[model samples]
Target: MKIIISEIPKEGLDVKLKEKVESENISSTVIAQLRIEKLEIEVIVSGDLAAEVKLECSRCLKDFNSKLMIPVNVVYHPVEELKGEDNYEVRHEELDMDFYSGEELNLSNLLKEQLMLNMPMKPLCADLCKGICPVCGKDLNIDKCTCTITKTDPRFEGLKKLLK
Candidate 1:
């Protein structure tokens, strides 16, 4: 889904897409409703990207699906601005800025990036997941394990005596 920069009309372009993204990060089909506006050489792409992402629980290690709707608000600058060796600092507004080369703006890549950014760093099936038992290797949520576990750091031995 590439939007040619030169072909954009003065009234802007509206695009509605439902396609599976070809990326390692995204596993499910994505639906995007985007409005592309051109202000001089800069392109502003704003829309909502909807997708169902398959995620694995960090604690229980169970696979689950999460539905996400990420709001797209990105300003694309010419790739030539990224050239030269001049040192620069990025401002707060520039956080949403991206660089594009040539007349094509790949919306698929944009959707992939937005989806990745919106995904959780650590996915959990539930907040109070019991997780798997460390010693007996049994799912604590499903079954109980009779494994006496004691963990006391050597440095905390003196502190244990004080509590007693």
Candidate 2:
């Protein structure tokens, strides 16, 4: 979704929308809940986007469906005003009127940012996922494997002798 800065009035504007998902593009349907309130030429976007995506579990390496909720709140600044400032600082009160370049606002970048922030660092299907067996590379959650699970250290030979 693109919004032209010139279209928004000084009093600001509000937008509520829902985006549909295509099976070819994304695995799950996504809902984009947006509230765009304009302050002069700048626009303040505040909302939460929720979606369910199919992801592989990091530990078990199994496919799973996970829900994501991304909250967004950012100010758009005018391109001309944001140029050549060594230390650009905006006040808390000015958050509603952040500047951006050009009269058009690209919602793709903002959506991408929210998705990235909401992504899990380490995704797991379950807390106690048994994971896969190291030797035969078998998924332990499905069935038991005869692979011997051991921990050995080359520097521990002397320690082993002492214990024996």
lDDT of each: 0.84, 0.71
lDDT of candidate model 1 versus the reference: 0.84
Q: What TM-score does model 1 achieve against the real structure?
A: 0.80
* Highest lDDT model number: 1
Best by TM-score: 1
Residue 10's lDDT in candidate 2:
65
* Model 2 RMSD, rounded to 1 decimal: 6.8
Q: Please, what are the lDDT tens digits per residue for candidate 2 over residues 9-70?
A: 66565655555444433455567777776766557888878878777888789989998887
User: What is the number of residue pairs that collide in model 2?
Assistant: 10
Q: Report the lDDT of model 1 for residue 40.
A: 89
Write one digit per residue (lDDT tens) for candidate 1, span 1-164: 89889999999999999878656656879999999999888889988999988988888888989888888889888888778848744443843888799989999889888888888998888899888887877878887566632455668868877998
